[model samples]
Target: MNDILFRHNRPDRAATFEEYRAEGGFQALQKALADLSPDAVQQTVIDSGLRGRGGAGFPTGKKWSFVPRNLPGPRYLICNCDEMEPGTYKDRVLLERNPYLLVEGMALACYALGVERAFIFIRRGYELAALNLKGAIAQTHKAGFLGSAICGSGFNLELDVHQSAGRYICGEETALMNALEGIRANPRSKPPFPAVKGLWGQPTVVNNVETLSNIPAIVAHGPAWFKALAATPEGAGTKLFCVSGHVQSPLCLELPIGTTLGEIIDTHCNGMRTGSTFKACIPGGASTPYFTKDHWTVPLDFDPVAKAGSRLGTGGIVVFDQSTCMVAATLNLVRFFARESCGWCTPCREGLPFVQHTLERIESGRGDLADIDILREHVHKLNYAFCALAPGAMGPVEGLLRLFEDEVREHITGGKCPVKG
Candidate 1:
């Protein structure tokens, strides 16, 4: 396992701050503050071709570039650590192992963008991670890596670890900003993206926990070295995949970006559990479309997964065995999304519930043949929801219709879950 992001997972406990520093942890920040210009740091990331790990594969550097550097009262940096996406826990794992990485990385980001303050919007459920981060913050503050004039570089950054009363929508950057500001966690419409105006109407950059963690390495090593870390030429760096469901050994594994799904399953996960055969898998998180055995060979990367009719969302893999009912599985996922709706828009608020009902009816053997068509229509319509939440909510259902249409029809015709037999 060529693990870059998660190379130092100590089963005993998280590495101490001194141990991290001794192994050349904060050297990246030191280099950034003393040697490189802000533009230089940003350009290094851009050149490395690092894309966001949090669902959307937006270029991290481009997202940073959107922050209007000049016209700002108090430009802010936020790490979206409120990881509530179903089947996704890479951020939580990263923080549990080493919260210092995120701190160092965010500090580098603040310097790169000339921001004086940053926030880590962590989930309340992640009590351990939150505590570790709080400890890391204190250690950094005392070590002069955080707070006013960090490392004597005239870069003042105050770090706040906000253990959010988390909702799934708070994972959204704009909604996270709203939550940080103590407003409703509903997503704000993007015309002025967060980079232009966010977190108190100031220029901001909201990056995923994993995204920020990559900054230290990118700054420490050159872009070419980072780019070369991937198995695929087009892909950059390693991706942490939280593998779960029917896999024999369910655990998070860090593989080079663009590692094939088959490799991850056969090697890291040790394939499916006993008495089970691979039927389907959610290639990323719950919000991504499903992939079947036919797609086992597909590369588990952003572009390739999209090309395979799913997404590399959070790089979390949820395996499904042959005994699983697609309709029921999708229904369970849809229910979580429906319940997490912020009620800011109609399609997510109204559309998801209706979709969930239809799925339940079908799964319960009460569905009409016409209900399948209704689900298809709803999937298309929900894509236009105010935020990506609604569309994301439809991903599994869409996969069911596309990949398991025959199974859905069987449930209607056989009057029960046919896959059970």
Candidate 2:
């Protein structure tokens, strides 16, 4: 049994209000609300360097500070619960096991951001999570941690849990805001990021499930203590890496961020699956680029992984054993991107299918050298054509061409997949 920060206190069943209270859950909020000023709390988190756990590793406290605190209107603290990144399931686990952790985290964020109303924009697929969070919210309200006049402290705050239609695009904060407003789930252009103009046109502070969950701890443990939790200069605290695909043991383990890919694979994942040699891994989730066996020694931080040709997206470590076909794998992931494209723009809507068709042609043994050129061309053309979706779709394509160029060339030279037939 490994030690987990959030899940450590998880009971046999869902954590009850009494159980969570006994486990020292709401004490941080009480301390934060009572002793520290909102700016002080935000500064503590900023000093701690707690980055967003969602694919984008923006600093959580910094993101919160972007809200115009002095400009008074109805601000919101939105908990982004849309966990649709392929091979990424850690957020779901966090929400599933301990709903109160998220609630407490949200409360801390509300206090830090000075937002009166908060909403938990949960994905439609996460019915159980929604149910659990709703129950937890009710418990919090009853316990005086939520609703107006929390904990006898004159602060007025209210929290509501809303279900989204479960579109991947809705995971984007702006798109989520639009969905919450009872519109179609499509991403809005940024510049007026969610911090400035968000849910119901309020200065909103949006955070991922895991990102919000980190707040209570950061508040409880001072900034210095939080900084000490990290193995690198980047930040503090362990990351919940969702290890999946072609591994002997697939599970989520909270490890220090600077740990190497190979160490994580060998130790946590029990090495690769039997008869399968480690070929490459998507250090983050599917949206990040791939890393070959040679790059395994690199630390799995946002900066180091980027230097090694990948982003540490969501800390979702998906290892691909040698038995997997790189071309087929790209095709599979592209198909997902194409299907989930909100059809808002040309690049993601049209370019994705074109890329998908090109990969399908290659995998079906009907590909030519021109197909490779077209794939590269389409990726270049589609780069940044829409939201991050287009660029994310290009990650595996670009990674495949960089690392597995020979395998792709072999596919064209042999007029068939070398892996099969």
| lDDT of the candidates, in the order given | 0.89, 0.84
- Cα lDDT tens digits, model 2, 71-104, are 6678888888888889898877887778888888
lDDT of residue 154 for candidate 2? 76
Estimated TM-score for each candidate: 0.98, 0.96
Each candidate structure's count of clashing pairs: 0, 0
- Whose TM-score is greatest here? 1
- Write the residue-wise lDDT of candidate 1 on 11-53 in tens digits: 8688789988887888999889999999999999899899998
Candidate 1 deviant stretches above 4 angstroms: none
Q: CA shift at 131, candidate 2, in angstroms?
A: 1.7
Where's the lowest-lDDT run of ten residues in candidate 1?
Answer: 1-10
